[model samples]
Target: MKNVLRIIGAILGIVLAVYLVYQLRTIFVYIILAVVLSLLGRPLMNLLGKIRIKNFRLPNSLSALIVLIVMILFVVGIFSLFVPLIAQQARIVSSIEANEVARAFAEPLNRFSQFLADYELTEERFDEHYFRAQIRDILKFGKVSSVFQSIFGVLGNLFIAIFSVLFMGFFFLRDGMLLQRILETLVPDAEVPHVRVILDNTKRLLTRYCFGLVIQVALVTLIISVSLKFFLGIENALIIGFMAGLLNLIPYLGPVMGAILGVIIVMLTNLDLNFYSELLPKSGWILVIFACMQLFDNMITQPVLFANVVNAHPLEIFIVISVAGTLYGITGMIIAIPSYTVLRIIAKELFSQYKVVSSLTRNL
Candidate 1:
């Protein structure tokens, strides 16, 4: 009777905790951002600490402030560089005429439609006319002003969020164990050692993973930009490269989406060219470039980041990412491996007696 009651009480506690977390999700977001900032900024903080004038070194507060400013400037610089390019592309897509696009591709599109019909692949007729309608639907964005207005509306509280995150991040960088100290107060005194170990392991693993992501994005961007520049006649190769790099954040599915986007943009830019002989050739080369990039990424980069850095098996990472993507979508997929790594660290400390936990966290 006592055991049954205890089990029910435990389940109720878990439910209540989840409910509270959901209510305070925004605060959690800020904390997560602060933690990430602290991780990224810690190296700079260490470097600043080593700098001295005679016998005096930089203070922790001063170091943290410098690190914070540098990170902010980097972020602002990235936005400044990319935002205008993106906005320009969006304007081009939004303002382009569907009729003109259809007319440009009409000959090849008609031939392709006939091929599909001859093969009985399409149920109803599919031709340039059907594609012409899709052109408007696919590229439709009312205006750039309206789009940024919606973005500004959504980020209305962005100032407060940034300030809160920076404040927390400064302290986190100043005192590396600040997060662990806070977590300790929540757990029992007996569990303090476990919490400390968990936080330490998570920090190291996540730092490597985060840096790996940066390298991957930059490398992918470079490959795509170079490919488009030399192999294709596209005018907006830089913007397309940036788009591919950003979308590559979504694991497994990202490369395919990037390829499709590359093709679409290729068609859009070369509307004045002959679709069959001229445009098609360029599009084919772009796909080949994307394919080669993906092959390199999958074979080399992903294994190192997702498997080696996290100390998890490749199959284990795949399953975890798949489940997270199914449950919470793209954002979930992006964070899945890191989140799972943290969970494994915690479980190793707290549930090592369990066989499954022991096996999964054996590497950690």
Candidate 2:
């Protein structure tokens, strides 16, 4: 009877937990972001804690505050540097007449349309009207004002999200063990050791992985930006570089997309009658630079990040990302590796008796 009651209680507890999570999904997202930021800033916080002020060590709270301030300043500084450029680009894009853009691409697009018509894929020749209509439909250009309004709306929300994340992150950094204590109290006594192991491993692995990612993104951005500015002489190099680096969060497909975006930006901003003669060569050079960056990333940065920091096999990581991407699209792919790492750690701690879990998590 007691065992039956305990089983029922566990089921009820799980259902209640799920319901609460559903109700507080937005707050949960904030908390998750806070936790990640806390993990990323943990090393800095620890370093600050170690600093002695004459004969006094820095308190955890003060250390966390300093780290938070530094993080905020770093974020604000990057935005301050890039936001003007992005705004300039946005203005350029908005100022570009749709008809002019269509006219610029008219020749090549007509060739494509002719090919399709010849192949019986389409019954009509493509003209600027058709092209412009397609672009408008695809980009919702008819609602340009609304789109800008939505962007402003998102900016407002972003400010709120940043504040909430920082507020929660401060607590997480200062009282880093609070979550563990709560978990210890909530978990079954028999499973407390397993939970502790899981949490500890999670913190270590995730902190290293998050920090490694920051380094990887920054390196990629710098390499691309410098190469574009110095070699290709591309205007808006910083924006293109940052966009490429940010897109690289998607794993296998990201670098390719980034390269393509670089080419598009070059074409869009440098449209001229000499597109074939001069711009084409510049575009090729841009591709080459991106290719070199990708090569460096795959060869050097990735190996260290995966093997040394995350401790996952390359093949395993690839398969996990591919599966997640297939099942849930880009967002899934973005999260796949870290999610898999967490799962692997937990499985290793909780189900070490299982052969597959034990084998897969042997390194962890």
Candidate 3:
């Protein structure tokens, strides 16, 4: 009876905690971003700390501030370079008329729909006017004014989020032990030492993983951008390439998603061209380029970076990411490896006696 009471109490506590977390999710997001920034900046902070000039070493606060500034500058520089270009291209694409696009491609769409109908694949006949309306509906949100309006609408929340992340990130970087101290208070006194071990292990692993991830994203972005610039002469190649690199963060499914997006963007921008001869062929070539990129990533990039950084097998990473994606979607897939790494470390520390834990965390 006592055990049952204890179990029920624990369940209720968990439920309440989850409710609180959901309610305060925005704050949690800020904290998580700060933690990720700190993780990425830690090595730079340490390196700065080691600098000496005439028996003078940089203070923690100064080092942390410098690191934070450098990170901010890096992000700002990238945005400054790409944002205007992308925005201009977006304006141009948004100004495109749905009737113009529909007039150019409507026949092909109808023929494809008729083929489907002929094969009894779809009972509904494709209407040209309906198709043009659909095109207008799709392009409505593609309007530059609409896009900027959406962003403007969220400016207040966005500012708060950015400021909160920056504020917390500075402190986290400055006081390397800040996060540890917070955890120490939350963790039980008896289990503090064990928890500290888990924290250190998780941080070290995640730091390496994050570094490798940034490098991977950079390499992918450079390749795709260069390929499109030189091979296809696309105007907004950088935008598409950056998006592809970002999406490639997800395993298995991300490359295909990026490819589809690439096709859409290409088609949208090239709407004035011949659909079958120029536009369709260009879109096809995009698929080929993305396919080649995938092959290269699978053959060279992923194996080298992730295998070393995560210390897990391909199959293991795939299963974990797939399960996470199923449960929590794109965000889950993005965080799956780090989450799995931390879970494995915890299991190895606390449940090493169990055979399954031992087997799964063998690399760790």
Candidate 4:
């Protein structure tokens, strides 16, 4: 009877804990973001600490504040550089005439429709008029205005999230050991050493992973932008490059999406050109460029990142990303690596006796 009562009590406690966590999910997200930022910013904080002026050193709080300010400025600079380009693209898209665009692509579209019919792949002939009407509906002035308004609404929410993260990160950086001490208190005395090992390994691996990701994104963006500008004479090269690089965060699906988006943008903006003579050929080249970029990323950047920084096998990373994407979508895929890394560390620490765990985390 005592054992039954204890089991019931334990189940109730688990239920209550899950419910509380669900209710405070937003706060949890903020805390996680703060922790990541603090880890990423630790080197900067340490560098600031090394600056001593005649037996006086900057306080940790002040150092954190300076790092925060620098981060904010860097973010603001990025926005300032990209916002005008995005606005210009929005205006151009809004001004495009669906009828004209349809006329430009009519020949190739008709050919495609005939091919589909020839292959018995489609039941109805593709209708350019219907396509034009759909495009017109999408590009209507009110629709465009509403789209911009929705974007602004999302940006407002993002700003709030960013500010909250920065606020929490400042304290985390200043009191670096405070979180560790708190965790130690929460764990059983015997498990405290294991928890510390997990935490330390997690921090080290995640910090390197974060820095590696930044380098990967920047390298991809530079490669695409420079290639497009120099080889293709594409006017919106920077915007396309940035979009592709940002989409690359989605793992397997990302490069494909980026390629498609790049081709579509190039085609849409150059609708005045003959479809077969100029637009299609140019768009194909753009795709080839993006494909090469993805090849470089996969062959070079990703191998180095996974092998050295995250210290995970390529196959392991792929399996983790695939499963996470299947279950939780793009966001899941983006975070799969770091989350898997942490899980591996914890598993190795707690279950070192298991041969599988020992083998999997031998490097870690």
TM, every model: 0.87, 0.87, 0.88, 0.90
lDDT of 2 by residue, 201-314 (tens): 888888878877888889999999999998877788999989988999889899999999988878878766465678778989988998899889988998887665457777
Question: What are the per-residue Cα lDDT tens digits for candidate 4 across 235-294?
Answer: 999999988888988888988998898888888898878787888889899989988998
Output the TM-score of candidate 1: 0.87
lDDT of 2 at 281: 85
Residue 315 lDDT, candidate 1, scale 0-100 = 93
Total clashing pairs in model 3:
0
lDDT of 1 by residue, 1-364 (tens): 9867855875696689768866897788789889998998888888898899999988898899889999989989977988998888878876678898888877777888889889999876567799888876665566546777888977978888989999999999999878888889997898798888888888888888888888899889888998898777577888788889989999888888998998998788668887678888888888899999999998888787666557777798899999989977897898887888888887788768778989998988
Q: Report, for every candidate in turn, its global Cα lDDT versus the true structure.
A: 0.84, 0.84, 0.85, 0.85
Q: Would you list the clashing residue pairs of candidate 4?
A: none
In the predicted model 1, the residue pairs found to clash are: none
